[model samples]
Target: DRLKEFPCRIEYLSRLKSASQQREICEALKAGKIDIVIGTHALLRDSVRFKDLGLLIVDEEQKFGVSAKEKLKALSRQVDTLTLTATPIPRTLQFSLMGARDMSIIRTPPPNRYPISTMVSVFDEQLVAHAIREELARGGQVFFVHNEVNKLPQLHAMLLRNLPTVRCAVAHGQMRPSEIEEVMLDFMAGDYDVLLCTSIVESGLDIPNANTIIINNGHRFGLSDLHQLRGRVGRTNRKAYCYIFTPPLDVLTPEARRRVAAIEEFSDLGSGIQISMQDLDIRGAGNLLGAEQSGFIVDLGMETYQKILDDAIRELKYGEFSELYGDELSNEGEWVRAQDCQVETDLDVALPESFVRSATDRIAIYREIDLLQDESALNQFEKSLEDRFGHLPERVKSLLTIPPMRWKAASVGVEKLQLKGGRLSLHFMSPGDSPYYGSQTFAKVQGQLSRYAHACRVRQMEDHLRVDVDGVQTVGEAMTFLDYLSNG
Candidate 1:
């Protein structure tokens, strides 16, 4: 019978020790005994074959050997293959760019994923002990990351000396497969309070209970690596802390500063999207495509690079891309407005965040929009702006700076539109029949034009100020009561 949790029937392919089960499963897959299976490299073998395989999903594709990965690809030929890896390779980025692969980002670290508060300081035993105690007090586990596996014993001894009562263990790749699994299982089961280990803990393990991490010699790691490592903890709602300790003797590298700084910057939810995470996305894109595309990204920048990819995707999807490379596009304003005619005027307009993300993005977006010869496209793009951001929020409204030209007009005694008392009111006109004139006041004539008193005075005011009322008609004057005024 199919298991309730799984869509397909589940069966045990072999009965063997955990160490040897991977190879056994690979042989089983080769013989077509399992519909879908999960195992490590031990499951990778020449004999492995699938009988009408529908999908092959491999988690952590980076761990696979190049030849093995290539062979695996062939196995899923003409079938959908979903390879997952936390550290995305350049090839994956290319595939996403070229539309060869579908990518989904779990960028929002799970809900209540407390951003790990990281601190960079010289190694200190007291600080380490205090952090460990604090986390354990909150019923959380700790990961003491020390990359050097050879110094595992010495490190463990130091950790013991600092916190002798705390249960702890060490793990590395050199350990036997069973031993590594046992330690991981014990740690997962909450058998250990702390795990002093290598970078193997970077991905594929979710331990919400682990809320604190201490990375020894963290400056040695790259930004991406450090991000991945930091991601290991703070899976729960409780605030997590990651302390990166580096010796003062070591000259702090720029990359190290960037890594630590990113960890600090992203402590708030949804805040790190623009920085470290984007770099990961870019790196992933580069990995999937190839190193050759890296230069294109560096030259054009990430936003521009993404725009090019988006354009290519649209062209491939719709079969009609208006702007071809090397096409001479005119920037005449009249032509732009003409193109916009295809779009209904009533359609709501929206200003793209690309226009608002930063000054650079805004300038580039403006330039790109200007180059568009298609009127409907521009209108559609504008409509997108209105729909996405809605009526401008107060925060955005605050950024509005009245043009200097208008400021000059106000200074020269010219009345202009302004927001006064939350309503637009004339600078010189008022409800009460009072002369509300500025410093260089000339004339303030108010009364119905139909009234003889108003008619004679209006003429006098217009003549004195040299104001032209020529060929101008006021409908309200002869019907409903209206007021007139002239001032300097």
Candidate 2:
């Protein structure tokens, strides 16, 4: 009915339809007579072609097979594409996190929506009966998900025997498409009080009246699957309930226990992102770039991979060197060692327990500090810490000086800077081997070092130059001396 009011023609194509119907739809699409077409993977077939497709929208994108997505990608290159998903697969989420793709998140739930009350417990038939009775008394419906199709009949019979007065129906993927559609429509029209179904209800189904869900063998499903199943309920102002039934905690696998616990903990509205991050932690993020890159990422570790990825993106976007590598160095088109600086100091540079309580949070802060690329980032981090955790302690302030020291070290071509045993050592790569070594800046630095001969000693090793400065006992003194060397 809505299609009649639209300015453009619309067509629907599906594998379930007759061959003549599909052919007519294909012809209409190819002739540009149809401005909009909705269908399944049949649309990706070579026989089906679009004349002037402008936008392609994929819903439940995570449910599509790899080949279908690949085919969609081929089509997407020529048109704008938008993907919608409640729970994104880890690969898609990783791409968005790494800035390879753009993503917009809708955190706001509809008005009058309340957080679903979730509970994980050992399966009890009486408890299930009680929940169903409560929802039924309130004029609502229920979804009882039992994944195994072979056992669904047994479960359905049990439900009927337990609560004979309540109307019940079964729906699963193994059922005929027409049968499934009929059962779903019947449920939608309030013909059934409860629908016994499989994970097929995990996507593209919404029933505002179905405010109670009971999943059998919930521990057998993945975290995202559990989340999606739970999402089927709680669509209206009425309060909803989700019961995740599993075996005893002691009997369940460790992974299953964790999944159940996580689902229970994150029951608030708009917690999908948090749940997805937990999914990534449990399941490793596969290769985002390609298959070959997966091996590199595993070998480099996620932290190092993130640093390299950030560097590559920055270099491509702004033609700048990596944060760790000060600048690119090449000799006659031959790659040389990356011009970088390292700081190795034995100072007690760590967050105090009195300052930040959580060990996990401290480690997170350390990673953030390790990735600081510029003075502005460092300053901002310090300010944030002070704002969140109160005044910066003396040691914390000293720790903030490390990044600038590293930046100063790179400026003077010092590849390695070490402070230990009341002495500071600056290691420089060989002049002949380094592109930055023979520059006028290097000469000026050398001249400046010669002036401080009394306090600093310079030695020419077989492959590099080493400068040692005595009496740098504290981190502050080390910072002061490095500042002098970099500025001089």
Winning candidate number (TM-score): 2
Q: After TM-score superposition, what is the CA distance of residue 223 in candidate 2 from its true location, in Å? A: 3.0
Candidate 2 lDDT over residue span 132-221, tens digit each: 999999999999999999999898888888999989999998888889999999999999999999998997788899999999999999
**Candidate 1, residue 302: lDDT:** 58
Model 1 C-alpha lDDT per residue in residues 1-488, reported as the tens digit of each score: 33548765333432224536656665666577776665555445565555567877787665565567777777777988777665454455455545677776556656555656778889898999999999999899999999998888998998899888999988887888678889998999999999999998987678888889999988787555676788788777888888988867347765456556666666655443344444544343443332232232444655555556764554443234334621322222111111111111111233446336667756654455534444466556556645754564443332221222223223322332333222222232221221123222222222222333422323223212211222222222211111233221
lDDT of residue 221 for candidate 2: 95
TM-score for all models, in order of appearance: 0.56, 0.74
Candidate 2 Cα errors over 4 Å, as ranges: 1-5, 249-258, 288-301, 304-345, 349-419, 424-470, 473-488
State the lDDT at 144 in candidate 2: 96
